[model samples]
Target: MTPPRVLAVAGSDSCAGAGLQADLKTLASLGCYGMTAVTAVTAQNTRGVSRVMPVPPDMVRAQMEAVLEDIGADAVKIGMLGSPENAEAVGEILGTLKGVPVVLDPVMAAQSGDGLNAEETPRALLAHVMPRVTVMTPNIPEAEKLTGLVVASLDGMEAAARRLVAMGCSNVLLKGGHFGGHDCPDLLFEGETGQLTRFAAPRIETRNDHGTGCTLASALAAYLARGLSLCEAARQAKTYTSGALQGAVSQQLGSGHGPLAHFHSGLL
Candidate 1:
């Protein structure tokens, strides 16, 4: 049997922890074949993103067309579109590829606190991409940015999720890491059904969580590619990420935030 195919449209993180690299690793780990259309290149390590150069819009669109026209994708995961143009390019491709599930991670800020997208990119995403997405995964800050609402508590996160649904997203996963609590809570709002589901896991005490958002979003896309429901995909992704974080706690690779153990399941 052939593995599910997932197309990841995102930026490249040279350290391989987040962005396109992390998405590829997560998809592969979750039993999916990964392909990519890189929107930007970043000089980054586990420590931080030092520099970034965005790929031209034409080149970005060409990569997407080449992959989708040939291999085709069961699912698509989008992240870190460096500019409004890049976001629109990705959105145009999404519009063309009908019936494929799209999981979008609105990655505005990096784990190292670097801004990845321009101020106009978020608005462009709302205008062009959000309506077409099957699911959107955003950390609290990103959610707040997208919705212009404060997410200081779990209730606030839920409100933000609903607002995002109003903004035309089919579903929203509001990640609760920025709440700064002992337990990390994530809220999943199903736009079509008006159902809200919550997933909570103990926050792992580790500094090596640089690519966690990308990992989760990619894992969700991988599971969707394998024909799992959105809720089931999110559940499996949370468990997978928790294990990766715990397994990599002791192996520090960079001076700042480090990479999760992408190969943890193999080591077991």
Candidate 2:
């Protein structure tokens, strides 16, 4: 059988720990053929992002068109858009996909606490991207920024998920890793059915957590492309991500936050 095809619209990470690199790794590891439309190029390592050059919106669109118009995509994963214009560009593409599932990872900051998007980027995502997203994945800080709600607890995550659904997203995946507990839980709210599902996994203590959000979002897209239901896709993605995190526990990489072992399912 042909491999699932997934397009990753994100930035490029120099260190390969996050952004397009991580997205590609996750998608490939999950048996998906990955393509990319880089929104920005960042000089970043596990320590931090030093500089970022936003790709022109027209060029970003051109890249997406070149791949999507030719090969097409079974699913799409959108991450750090860098600029509001680029966000709109991605939204325009979403309008044409029809039924293809889109996993949007609202990547606002790096694991090293460096801001990745512009001030206007969030507004653009809310206005242009949210309504088209099949599964919108936002970490605690991102959910707070998008919903203006304190997402410090499980209840807060529930409220924030509802707010995101109200804001036009088809579904919301509120990632609770930033809540800092013994168990990290993610809440998925399906807008159509009003069903909320909670996925829990023990938090692995490791500095190699960089790119986790990108990895999870990409894995979700891969699973969706492979014909899994939303809930099942989320479950499998979480399991894959947990294993990746666990596999990286002994890895000694950069001085700061490193990356997850994306190929943990097989290679050791």
The TM-score leader among the candidates is 2
The runs of at least 3 residues in candidate 1 whose Cα sits more than 4 Å from the true structure, single-residue gaps closed, are none
At residue 129, candidate 2 shows an lDDT of: 88
Q: What is the alpha-carbon lDDT of model 2 when measured against the actual structure?
A: 0.93
Prediction 1 global C-alpha lDDT: 0.90
Q: lDDT: which candidate is best?
A: 2
- C-alpha TM-scores of all predictions: 0.98, 0.98
Q: Go through the candidates in order and give each one's C-alpha lDDT.
A: 0.90, 0.93
- The C-alpha stretches of model 2 lying farther than 4 A from their native spots are none
Tens digits of per-residue lDDT, candidate 2, 5-101, equal 9999999999999999999999888889999999999999989999988999999999999999899999999999999999999899888888899
Give every collision pair in model 2: none
State residue 89's C-alpha deviation in candidate 1, in Å: 1.0
Please write out the lDDT profile of model 1 over residues 47-148, one tens digit for every residue: 788898899999999999999999999999999889999888888889987889999999888898988888899999999988889999999988988899
